[model samples]
Target chain A: MSVYTPLNEEQIIEILSNYSIGKSGVVDGIKEGITNSNYFLKTSVSEYVLTIFEDDNVNLDFCLNYMEHLARKSIPCPQPIQTNSNDSYILYDKKKLAIFSKLKGQTVSNAKITNEMCSQVGKVLAQMHMYSEDFKKNFSGVRNRDWFLNTYNKVQGELNKENASLLDEEIKRYLNYDCKELPTGIIHSDLFRDNVMFQKNTLTGVLDFYYACNGYFIYDLAITVNDWCTNSTFKIDHDKQKSLIGAYEQVRRLKNIEKKEWNTMLRFASLRFWLSRLNDQLFPTDGDLTTVLDPDHFKNILKDRKNYSDKLE
Target chain B: MSVYTPLNEEQIIEILSNYSIGKSGVVDGIKEGITNSNYFLKTSVSEYVLTIFEDDNVNLDFCLNYMEHLARKSIPCPQPIQTNSNDSYILYDKKKLAIFSKLKGQTVSNAKITNEMCSQVGKVLAQMHMYSEDFKKNFSGVRNRDWFLNTYNKVQGELNKENASLLDEEIKRYLNYDCKELPTGIIHSDLFRDNVMFQKNTLTGVLDFYYACNGYFIYDLAITVNDWCTNSTFKIDHDKQKSLIGAYEQVRRLKNIEKKEWNTMLRFASLRFWLSRLNDQLFPTDGDLTTVLDPDHFKNILKDRKNYSDKLE
Candidate 1:
């Protein structure tokens, strides 16, 4: 939600010369994306989003290739605009950068997420999972089980006894309960309601694949359900949940192992976000303008997922 | 460059219900405007910019009427969007808010302001002044001369001997100086490069009229020239100044008094911004996402304008 790199017009024109996207007209810094500085770059041809990755940890190559792979399969995702030299990325002030065709449509906020909208999102998620299988490159998602353990250890002193014990129990649960037979694919692990854009009744675009990596397919579904199917008070709207999962199953039926471990996956997803948000609150990064999401939202979700496991039935 | 208010879908939809702008689709918080919260609202019918005034001093009625007056003359500015009840302003969270038809085109950054571009800006600015003469409402710009004396007095203790004397002398000179016959009208007193938008060679829009009020038009021109014509090292680019002022003369010839007081107006504009920026640095406001512009930029401009007063000829 901030422009880290303030580029001048000459720099923008020089950057555009490396691409076949024609001359740059208007380059407005978009106050979106926490990890990268994003700009809405317009040209005579069309509009493109020029992104400069601020975080050193992001692997630009893998993210670009993955989006390209999905785009090649007619998936509604932002396709990276290749350079004239046929390179996927550019070097700007030593920061890894890329231009992407701006995705049209607006993100449907959680309050606007109807059962039908959830169903659409679920179908799109399934399609992305199916298409991402052929992606040859691999990058492990950043927020893995190890991240949970490390983050919890860092913020353990700050958490109350209840939260600390709950985190410990959840960490042990995820580490101990492993099902290698479960389905796996490239998952948009951060598929929040804010990440998907809708055009009327149709889901026009899916965005922010910075968290994309090989992960349990059912876990990805849980992440989506936790966000899109949850109300402001963190209660699950069962209609949204059923519609989303039912529509997803219509495209690709869940494996027996996935179905058996669905409740556990929901708990795992809830705890993952709760730990990350807690870490952000306790031990924040040096990003000039980073949004600190409330950890209590996911804490409530974790509590609800645990005590009301029967409610999911 | 930040969103102060984060509205959810229901809030946005409810807000749009007050207007006839159709159903809201996308409500993106635009990270512009330091003194107000702004959002780019897209609907099925058209686009509008929603602004929530953060400062209590803003006269909403005067500002709206001034814009409506200019808009009636087909001036290239955002027209205020009225509510279903025909009220221009709405009360949202106790903040005075209004919707304006989103202006087209992109702001030309300082580095991209070519001589011809500056000329176009000058022409449009002159036209705005001409069109705004009949504006009935009166709101003295908050950054008027008296503000300089008050702010400088407030921050004098923090300034060094040399700096304090410079401010004292400037204030005394402004207070003693008399030019009662100079052209005065509704002026866009802060027409910095980022505030004006251009499409190709043509000026498409001018924005941020929150600073618009009854003031010496020459002083407004001086403020603009100080920004648009200054280079990296804060030296006035003589060619840009010549081109801009020359083109402005073609629309509305500068009065003899204006020309005689040109150097004084230049110093006045510099002093006004310097005091304001210094005040911001010294005594900051409680705005959630207020941008603190460097006071040194205007200070340097004042230094250069004083030392090289002969260069303007």
Candidate 2:
């Protein structure tokens, strides 16, 4: 993650003039965000994060307004700061720039995660799902079924023969389970450890809603569990998984269908990340501060989920 | 180049507190320098550049003072801005930070070069070499004989069989040359196109002197010509080379010994960039705006210089 299109003082000042932020202060390039340039900015009034979206293909209108809607309903997420003109985003040099109130705490490293932290995350995820149910924004996620097929094709050759065969078999198996019966709503489709903020012992904030879209709620939990409950060996920490899911069910009980499809959801989630990580490793774009994760991490996770599925109960 | 270290507004304000250059303004990450994070900064007083040197290995004292000295003597170089305490640099998180007056004009791309532009660059280079003569800082370059050998070893396997053989032959031939007789002075060893800036028809500013050190004058000319006089095909444009060297000689004439070793210097200069490009390509670090140039560009240049040596006179 890195700042792609750099903003100079004059440029930033020009952007801030639309808002009553009382002049642009320090604009630091943050080492966060995958497809966007981020800055930790400060004004006289409040701390903010200035995001410049690099990829133009994503749904900005839904993503921007969705966060505001969720925030209004008491979801602990970054609320978008509207301009004086009430514009959601400003266009500078064809790149979309927007500011949001800074989240409360730092992102937790995966290794340092505890069961309490996982439980907090679980509650937030459930709350966000319920809060965003009525937001009424229709965005099929960027990483949907088509994404899996296309991404699999791109990264197919990068893996070893055994891994590649496993990936091929997994993709075929995941695509066959046409989960048209599962409950679909607004899901934070990509909630990794880095996308969460922990203050002291509690999850104070949920960050990075770029991938939030209309998807299966259980699939969203699968994405979260894959990142949060997993340890360094690419295997599940059963205690953390239990804590997260238990806390989650306390908010809203899972449907029997969601529970039946939970293991498949986990397998598909691992495959999605594996395919993405492989794509990044094999064919990465140039960036000043891009972090390409090892594909093997997710590959092992996919294998684990496929061979020995975890129980949600 | 990309910003490696991120500075929050509070952190930036703390750093700016040691200076009387007004409150911290927009600190935009700049895409410059291989081993440093740079920012385009502005305040009420003037627009400036903030550089955070990443590598602890480089000689900062000589490089900083050298620029100020050259700027004082009519060279188009960035002059360092001193802190309120009259210190040349300030330390933050063990990294040396300094401000410089932003250079006028933008860096010209390679395909847009003209004879007049090349001549202007040559005149500026010659003048800089002369003006920097009495600065009296003794520092050997980072990319010296040892670097050549070490870098070659690292990138040897990355090349094809033919290219590897050619590189081995060139390095062996280059190391045998005894250039002790050549007039040695301060040289901008990595005088690539991006390092020189132009506004309209004239060379307005010279930037990025991290590689500035005591070296051969003609060798420096070789570095400049290899960048300015070369086309995208990695072959020299003879008219541009003639125009450049012709102007440089009018300012400070080249020695007979310098002329004799000119072709070897060109090949060695090509080798330096080749090794660096290969290193960057094979083992690139994470950056937000990093541009890893194709190693083949310099490989072609090395091949061209070795096969057909150009005349400097």
Candidate 3:
């Protein structure tokens, strides 16, 4: 159970019927996620997914617009199903609801994620990131640090003095460090394995865009490699990473500063998740029944970042 | 500025004077962290750290008691400064706070964390883990999968559908995998460089008990290695890892299951932090004016963990 109210089958069906294309009769609730209420929908005409906005309305809007733009640029993504009146979305009962064409394929879950898959994901990200104008025109939100501090403060009481101090120091270091500016665009902030769909060896679609925001494009690549390239452990799969980076660079062509910032960014990315999970574990909200992740898992990653940073020097 | 209200200088001085046997003079706030407020105090006779609890009052009490027990067992730690009424802690303005004798030492912060230092930290962890009767009697927090799930849910919004599904699958897999039951005792949840103070080559004091909970002994060894040992590129320094593990095993032999779980735990640990930090970067707080770490660093660590897990297999 998430910390938000869930939508039932009737509610979902009613919303889908208002879309440009009426429902195709496939409506099944997805019970896997801890954040939103997702339903797999298929109409007599086409397949789609009906997602009810459960959190962060502004972010959802950003993602929806970004996806619509990506679809226009020939990036393979789920297109938004408009209302019967041709409206892209409908505000129903305080929930901003939208329907998307159901992406056809299976998610790569095991340790067998291939180099080819990594390359494709990377390439897609590069292409999506190339849309600098669309992102600049469409979405504007807080930077990564601001988001972290806001969430961290909400659950600050759950942390200890030492952990809190370390967090504070890390925040300060990030503030003081000169962050390299890169091509800014819409970034798929969460590009883990499940967010991607594959049909056999063919890449199908990039799924979740709730965290999609205007930021450094490289950050998306970082998120993808972080999710798909690695296994359950914290080791770097050289072949996969190489393939992914190669594919991304083939499109974006890494600048000197981007490459220089790569290792640090990697460390920062790893630490970012670790700290966020730590905050969640410390402070929980109502209706949130999801299990808290272990803070210890990222300990090695932090250590690795320290080492990685040293090597860069 | 954390969400938790911090004590003023005068309040800290009052607490110090009311708690310790010595005369309190100047109380200078050291740092306010995500979990605790720290103040460096100087009395006419000695110096001490005034720590205010920000979260988990019960766990904090357990940690304090456990630390006192460890001190009695000849472990090097800051001695708790008792209050005027002989209480180790006092409730001031609805917050739990304590004072402790401040040890004189410098915290290691450079990238040159030596193998010897790693070995020493590992050894100390082993020693701490070896305590059975008294330690277990004093602390009883169980380490389980629920901890990880809580964290996973916190950032579920940022995760894509495929990644979210993968997380669910991983959770189920973890539930089926039986964790090795070891001697349950107080373990230092966070044992990174900043927490361990040193004078010359000698370990002076180990700080940060906020994350100290009852968990497996091997997990402590893993945490220590995860924090203390790393390569220049921030990959787990394999050589340092070996040294740390060897030092730990020299004191506390690894059981077959413990050894088996080692690699997986390493991966899990890396992922844990990666996910956490990513959450922080995505949603920040106000008082957390610190830097939001990049989510990419842990992605690299996860990649590293994949490689390491393969090697272990």
CAPRI-style grade of the A/B interface in model 1? incorrect
DockQ of each: 0.01, 0.01, 0.01
Better of 1 and 3 by TM-score: 1
Per-residue alpha-carbon lDDT of model 2 for B1-313, expressed as tens digits?
A: 5556667888778877866454566678876666778888765334678888777877899898787656533355776766656677899888889877676689886448889998888887887776555566788878888888888888898888987898889889877877689998889897778888887676878888888888889889999998888887889999999999988876677888889888898998888888888888888867633688887888888888888866655
lDDT of 1 at B75: 53
Lowest lDDT sum, 10 consecutive residues, model 3 chain A, at A304-313
Candidate 1 lDDT:
0.78
Q: Give all candidates' CA lDDT scores.
A: 0.78, 0.79, 0.64
Which residues of candidate 3, in runs, are more than 4 Å off? A1-13, A23-26, A134-143, A154-157, A160-162, A231-233, A310-313, B1-313
Q: How well is candidate 1 docked (DockQ)?
A: 0.01
For A1-313, candidate 1 gives per-residue lDDT tens digits of 5646677889988887776555555688987677788889876444678888778777667887777665543356777765655577888789888888776688876446789999988887887776565566777878876777777789888988998898888888988877899898889898898889887687878899888988999999999999988877777888899999888876667887887787788899999899888988887777744689899999999988888663333
Ranking by TM-score: 1, 2, 3
How well is each residue in B1-313 modelled by candidate 3, as lDDT tens digits?
Answer: 2343445657656665564233335666664345577777665334567777665445766777777555433345666654556466888778888877676576786536878877777766765665333453454442346656676777777777865665565555555766647455667766878788787776767887767777766667666676677554657787788777777766666777777777666666556566667667766755543456666665566566667663321
Candidate 1: count of backbone clashes, pairs at least 3 residues apart or interchain? 0
Q: What is the TM-score of chain A alone in each candidate?
A: 0.96, 0.95, 0.86
